[model samples]
Target: MNMSWKGVMPAMTTKFTDDDRLDLKMFEVNLKAQMKAGVDALILGGSLGEASTLLEEEKSVLTRAAVDMVDGKIPIVVNIAEQATKAAMNAAETAEQDGASGLMILPPMRYKADDRETVTYFQEIAKSTSLPIMIYNNPVDYKIHVTLEMFEELLKYDNIQAVKESTRDTTNITRLINRFGDRLKILGGVDTLALECLVMGADGWVAGLVCAFPEETVAIYRLVKAGRIDEAAAIFRWFLPLLELDINPKLVQNIKLAEVATGIGTENVRAPRLPLAGEERAQVLSIIENGMKTRPKLPDYLNL
Candidate 1:
């Protein structure tokens, strides 16, 4: 699958059973729904996918499962957030070998790599694999900003193809395009800012809430690109409350709760990250339920 790197690509939640094993059954259920809703790609083991908690073997399992299920329909992009340069490189290699079409690489995890270190890390990973890479430039959360200057240096590598723009500043999309032109693709990584990012000419959306609301997410992207601003804005307005859930510290649990409300997944998170409980649970549930109650009848935007 050639990665267009342009469309609604869900940063999917990793489904787990009551025993906390890889719930391939539920995973497949979500994957099929995303594909049916016309997403351009499938992204595995991302922040929303609980990449930090997943074992390396488990990431491989998720990658292979997604690869098998999607067949050749869309690209399966594996996320690599390893702290060590060697480990990140190895993960990139493994993802390619396991049939991933692309990778979303974060700046060195835990340690705040200086600009030089950050560029070197990405450059080395690019050297290790022929698969295309999307640098996850999430400085707000990750602390290591891959600045435009860093990108100027990193662009020499042909495999470093895109950036998952999560800086929370939508203008950075224009900044990247202004600087890099067509040299790099930009995918919106902030869920709340997705529509704005798209309107700003982002190549695509690396969506979080799409784990449960795939159709609505895709609808917004398609309508915006199709020049139906009012229609897209209408759906986005309805989606605003739920989309905001993706920015919270407990976003994984919040999105899983949304998934449960939509009848597509469970709220079972790994240990250290329990399901949203007490007042927090009720508040998130209120948001999810309210959204469900008012879930809009989507137009046939895809056909349009």
Candidate 2:
């Protein structure tokens, strides 16, 4: 499958049963909804998907389920976040065999590798699998930045094709375009910066809020790319509060809550992580409710 890598792709969250087992039914439901809403791709086992906590078997199950659910409607990319190069390589190979079309790889977790080590880690994984790779560069949460210089070296591989830009530095979008030109397809990895990044020449958006409000998310990307800034801005303004939820440390809980509110999925998470409660839950609910009540109407062209 040839993905354009130039539109809205949600870094989907993993759904769990009440017993915390992989909720394959709800997972398929969410995947179907995203496809129906016309998202460009489905990314499973991302940080948003609780990849850190998932067992190897669980990741394979999610990948296989996504591939089965999407069936060729869109590409399914699995995220690989491992501490060791060989582990990352094994994960990449497994994803490919499980029918994933691509991989989004982060640098070594726990111990932040230096620039050279980071480059080596990615290259080894790329060499191990034929699947296309998107280097995840989120310094804020992951703590290791895939610097421009490092990217220059890493992009030499044929399979290392794209970058998920989440440095939270808006200017880095322009810098990426200037430095790499068309060698790397840059996807906006932050929710709040989606429109700005698109306007600044980002090829696509790897969104978080889209897991809840897919139509609105795709509408914003389409409108902005179509040069309808005012229309896109209207949606963005209405979406800002909800999009803000994506940046919080408790984003998994917040987004899962939004999913439940929207009738898509549940708020059940795994061990060491619990559902939102008390005042915190109420505050997030307020923001989501306010957004829903005042949701912006899409233009006729959007047809949502």
Candidate 3:
């Protein structure tokens, strides 16, 4: 990706109402807090925001709220992915108009398509708006794989400048970097492996767990940026358990639960994607407690 960036860009948390509506005011508080922590940018309305579950209007409201809070102080990238090309394009265009610095584009979800169709889907979105684009590549996250060949193909779009590579495959980092050279700004999308990525020639990170732990997340980034990989890895190793939970199928619930525990946001996930069940809830809590014991104490962003 062409966008010049660095430091922690938390995937960010979305606040929800007791009635399950998108909560904009609390969202602003969270955004401003991240900015105050000296984060590089904000990824609003992203996977962590439960984008897939939000109504388009609710998303627009949430987008406008973030842009307003940021007030041009930092970059804000919106995650706009939908099963339909038109929906994705419209959301991207709307975010651009709403003052987002960029849009993170994922493949048109829900249906499988040939490589040609998949490439075209993204190309059309690139053509639809002038917003800077970051190709969201998480094969595991989407139940689909974006190959090196596809990465090469997509790089042809000049504005498709950055990527959030979340496969947790360390070897692919050098491979993608060697192939793309400086043409792409490869961001480590998975939080647990973020330091390893930076050590292996990746730039920046897209982390979901950071929603409740910006201090540690940004601390690791600053360390890595200063070539303090060993120190960064120490903290990352301690925080790995919490970061890994971002991948659990119940990630949304787990994240919300953590937010509630730390007092950053709420545990009120939307309907259809229900909240945690007995065993799942217990397991996720155990993971968080273990992480707290290993990592630094919860930062000011949390209730703890």
Candidate 4:
């Protein structure tokens, strides 16, 4: 599964010790469970992995754990988003050396770019790695939207194979699919929007919710692939609300909660970010507990 650009690839949470060190065992358990559930890819060191909260060393530890568990059964793509090209390149190189099958580059943080810098940024990262690169174009979260022209330019890099379109706008997915088509892998980066994205010709999901519900999410993708759009839509109905919650401000916390509530992993996260607590925590747990109640549990999710 070299650089799989399709199906449910969960943005895995980077587990942390109470002292804020990387929890390698928890990470390994999560990765193994996801693979057993048949996820198409393991997206580690990503938003849900809380990439911004991690030090380079911690990310390295997490990446190593993921690649080891996946064992090349599926593509292992890590998100490497640093403000400077060198830092991003280091992360990319480390992931590649550690056996990652691909890289997903988020725009540099804190100072999301206008058009020119955005194009240059991707070009620099693309130049640094031999691994297949997936550009993460999430303007809402990063305030940096790589335009269609920018994508066309990035397309020149043989290794710049995909774009995780997290724009939350189906129209943009349709626009990109119309213009680029098979030239680029158009992945749905948001879980709530996956079906709409698929209908608009997006090839797959770089999902956050899949960490908690891998089998269900993969089932949706398989249905879509089998041309059972109605069945896929049926699954989406149970999934979309939780997926929509993931797009909310509490996304990171909620995703961790989904993992914790369902016993796939812990909700422990590092600071600058904090775990959900008080009523906020209760509400998120309630959502996971309540929603998961109606359907039979998705395999790999711990049963109540």
Candidate 5:
């Protein structure tokens, strides 16, 4: 399947059993819900999907399950975040074999590679896989920014085709468009910045809050792209509070809590990561509850 990479793609959270195993059943439930809500694609095992904690074999299962569940309704892309060049290549190969439609790759994990090293790392992985790649460029969290010059170097590779732009510098979105134009598809990576990025011509959004509110997320994207800026802004104003949850350091727990509150999944996460608790938990729940109580009604066109 050829994915346009020009609309909403949820950076889905990995659903876990109460005892911390991959819950394929509930995962299918969530994927189906996103599809029913009109999401354009599904990206699994991203930072939002808890990729760092997941085992290699678990990623395979998740990839294959997503391919099966989506069944070509939308493209399923797997995220590869590894420390070694060879390991990243192997993961990319594995994702392709597992039937993933594409791959979202971060630079070498842990060690901050210089621009030369980052270019080489991405080049090596892109050479190894037939899957289309979306370079994950968030210097804030990943510590290695894929600068414009580095992207200029990377643009030589045909498959290094997209970017998950989360530099927190919205200006960089316009810069990317000015520099790369049609060569690279830009997907807004920060939930809080999705509206601004889209307004500034980001091709799509790799959204986190969509896990909890798929329809609203899709509605915002559609309305914005359709030139209904005022309608989109109204929903975005209401969404900003919940969307802020996606940028927190504890985003996985925060988003999962919202998922549980919204009745799509659970707040259960693996060890080293626990469910939200105490005052933080209360505060998060209050935000979600308040948003739910005063949710905006979908426009008549979107109601379809």
Candidate 6:
């Protein structure tokens, strides 16, 4: 599938079994739900997907699975988070070979690279593959900020086409537009600010909570694009509490629990990371349960 790099593209969580093996069964179930809800692409092994815990070969396996499963119906994008430029490049090349339609790459992990080193890192990875790249720009969490000036330097690479805008600042979307016009696509990376970013003319959303509430997430994008602000805002208001779950530090476990509640996924995560428990689990369940009870009846936005 050709990646348009637009619309709702989920940063999906990697599902695991009781023994921590890849739960491709549940993973495919979530993929079908995302496609059925009208997402444009699937991003695998992201921060939400627990990229750090996954082995390189495991990522390739997931990529291959998604590519074969989607079978050109939608693009499958693999996330690349490595400490070295060579490793990141290798991951990019491997993803391309494994049939990934695109890549979402974070800055050099563990060690924060300077402006020049960071640009070099992305530039080398861009040169390593023919796949389109979406730079994961989340300085708020990642520490290393890919500034607009750095972007100007990166514009030299044609394959570096878009940004997963998770800086937590909505103005960055407008700044990207004002500066680059249509040269670079901006996909909202933060779930809570997704609607605002779309309304501000962002081309897409790299969403988190969509794993559990695909319909609600896609509805906001479709309604906003269709110029139905009032309708979109109504759903957004109802979805705000659930959306907040994506912004927390334990977002992976939180959203997985949501998936369990929605009957679409399991709550098993890899070691070092466990399922939500005690009062924390109860609080998150309360939010998910309440949201499910009040789940809005979505319009046929796909037809629009």
Segments in model 2 whose C-alpha atoms lie over 4 Å from true places: 301-304
**What is the alpha-carbon lDDT of model 4 when measured against the actual structure?**
0.81
Question: Tens digits of per-residue lDDT for model 3 on 227-276?
Answer: 77777777888888888888777788888787766667777788777788
Summarize candidate 4's per-residue lDDT along 112-214 as a digit string, tens digits: 5778888888888888888999999888888988889888888999999999998878899878878988889989988888988887778888888888887
Give the alpha-carbon lDDT of every model.
Answer: 0.92, 0.90, 0.79, 0.81, 0.91, 0.93
* Clash totals for all candidate models: 0, 0, 6, 0, 0, 0
Which TM-score value belongs to model 3?
Answer: 0.91
Model 6 scores a TM of: 0.99
Q: Write the per-residue lDDT of candidate 2 for residues 186-263, one digit (tens) a residue.
A: 999999999899989999999999999999999998888889988999899999999999989899999999999888
Shift of residue 206 alpha carbon in model 4, Å: 0.7
Q: Which scores better on TM-score, 3 or 6? A: 6
RMSD in order of candidates: 0.8, 1.2, 3.5, 3.1, 1.1, 0.7
* Rank order (by lDDT, best first): 6, 1, 5, 2, 4, 3
lDDT by residue (171-260, candidate 6, tens digit) is 998999999999999999988899899999999999998999999999999999999999999999999999999989899999999998
Q: What lDDT is reached at residue 45 by model 3?
A: 71
Over 1-304, each residue of candidate 1 has an lDDT whose tens digit, in order, gives: 6777899989989999999899999999989999999999989998888888898899999899999999899999999989899999899889998999999999898898888889999999999999989999988998988899999999999888899998989989899999999899999999899999999999899999999999999999999999898899999999999999998999999999999887789988998899888999999999999999999999997797
lDDT, candidate 2, at 259: 95
lDDT of 1: 0.92
State the weakest 10-residue window (summed lDDT) of model 4: 295-304
Which of candidates 2 and 3 is the stronger one according to lDDT? 2
Give the best candidate by lDDT.
6
